[model samples]
Target: MWKFTLRRILIMIPQIILLSILIFILAKMMPGDALTGMIDPNVSPERLEELREKLGWNDPWHIQYADWVGGLVQGDFGQSFRFKMPVTELIGERIVNSFWLSVATLIFTYLIAIPLGILSGRYNDSLLDQTITGYTYLGFATPLFIFALVMLWVFGFMLGWFPTSGSVSPGSEPGTFAYVMSKINHLILPAIAMALIATVNTVQYLRSEIIDTKQKDFILTARAKGASESRVYNRHILRNSLLPIAAFFGYEITFLIGGTIFVETIYNYPGMGLLFFESITLRDYSVVTAVVLLFGVAAILGALLSDIILSLVDPRIRIK
Candidate 1:
């Protein structure tokens, strides 16, 4: 297991490096540079050139990339042209908001998906199964941003049950119960948007896997041995069935991060997604590159974690 884990971690290094190269290239190839967006139309050409030089736009692409990567290694993510702050600081604040939203969405998704999937699988071809299937299709068909907007209208505008946007209510003291409750209220629309988007697909995938496992020879043997139905399903089938779902978890996390961009924007939640969006609109290359690299590293780590989890769950996967 140690050897497997070490190998997975080693593999992530090259993946992160390659992702950095791609992001750097894409940022450079964009139609404008940071200076282009920063300069006023009436600014003299000489002043614009001075600003460009100050921002290192005068350097060769390779030189700039090397400096950027070097700074990255030293934990200096540079400054955001738009926000006039260190990219790291901006991202750090947003990370908390994004983390809460993602964690809540994850918990909600699994809570609603796993048990419902298990039940649907156990009662396959029944009315309950069909109903779940229908709901899953509906979820799959709907666009997440649209769902967020509609939810905002119903829950925020019409019912006035939750705040329309933002991470907390204005003037709410931080770290108090009131502040926490305000955060939760702000999270409701986006969380529901994320949950409704994820639950259907995850439940359907789990349902299929569980159903397949239930029909396996080992499951039949367990049943024939006079095991209780719950025991057979939970102890035997669920354990084996989780392998595929576990493998997919890492990919799903990355997808959730990307999906959060749209949902966060729609709900006006201050998160990495919103920051990334603002960075791009303002041509804040440093912020863009840092956020992309951060997300890439997250994806690589997630994959490594998934591999370790799979090995822990089933010893057969351990490296020799």
Candidate 2:
């Protein structure tokens, strides 16, 4: 396990390096200049040149990328063009919001998906199974932004049950329970949007695994031994069947980060998604590159964590 883990970490080094290079090239290739968003009509050409020089934008692309990579190694993510703050600080402030939203979405999806999947699998071909199948199809078919809009209209516009946007109510002091809960209230729409898209695939994967497990010889043996139905299903079947679901959970987390980009834009929530959107609009290369790298690291780490968990659970996955 240690060897495998070390190997995975080693592999990630080049992956990160490649991602950095790609982001650098992409940022450079983007049509607009970073200073385009910052410059005003009144700003003179000399002043703009001075600003570009100050930002090191006058340097060759390779030199800039090298400096950026070096600073990244030292934990300096560079300053944001839009916010005029360190990119790390900008990302840090928004990460918790994104993290909590993702957590909420995960909890919501898993709580509903696992049971629905189990029931669908256990009663395969029955009406209940058909119903779950229909639901899953509906979830998978609907686009995330559309779902978000519908949810916002129903929950926020018509019912007035939750706030439509923002992380927290403005002017609310941090660290207060009310403030935290209020932020969670704003999160509901986006969370549901995220969960709906995720739940469809999770249900399909889990249900397929459970149904397959049910037909295995060991399951038949357990039944022949006069094992209780619940024991056969939950203890033997679910225990083994959950391996795929466990793997899917990690993949789902990575997917959620990507989905959050669209969800956040629709709802105007202050998270990494919103930051990424803003960075693109403002041509904030530092912020854009930092966010891409951050998400890339998160995805790699999530996969690594999942592999470790799988190795622990299934003896077939040898340590070495």
Which 10 residues in a row give candidate 1 its minimum summed lDDT? Answer: 32-41
Leading candidate by lDDT: 2
Best by TM-score: 2
Please identify model 1 stretches exceeding 4 Å from their true place.
37-42, 317-320
For each of the candidates, give the backbone clash count. 0, 1
lDDT by residue (1-320, candidate 1, tens digit) is 78888888887888888899999999998888677754467888789899889878779988999999999889899988778889888999999999999888887887888888887887989999999999899988998888889999999999999898899999999989999999998987788778877888778988898889988999999999999998997798888776667766776678677878898888889999988888888888889989888888887887787778878877788778
lDDT of 1 at 21: 91
Cα lDDT for residue 18, model 2?
88
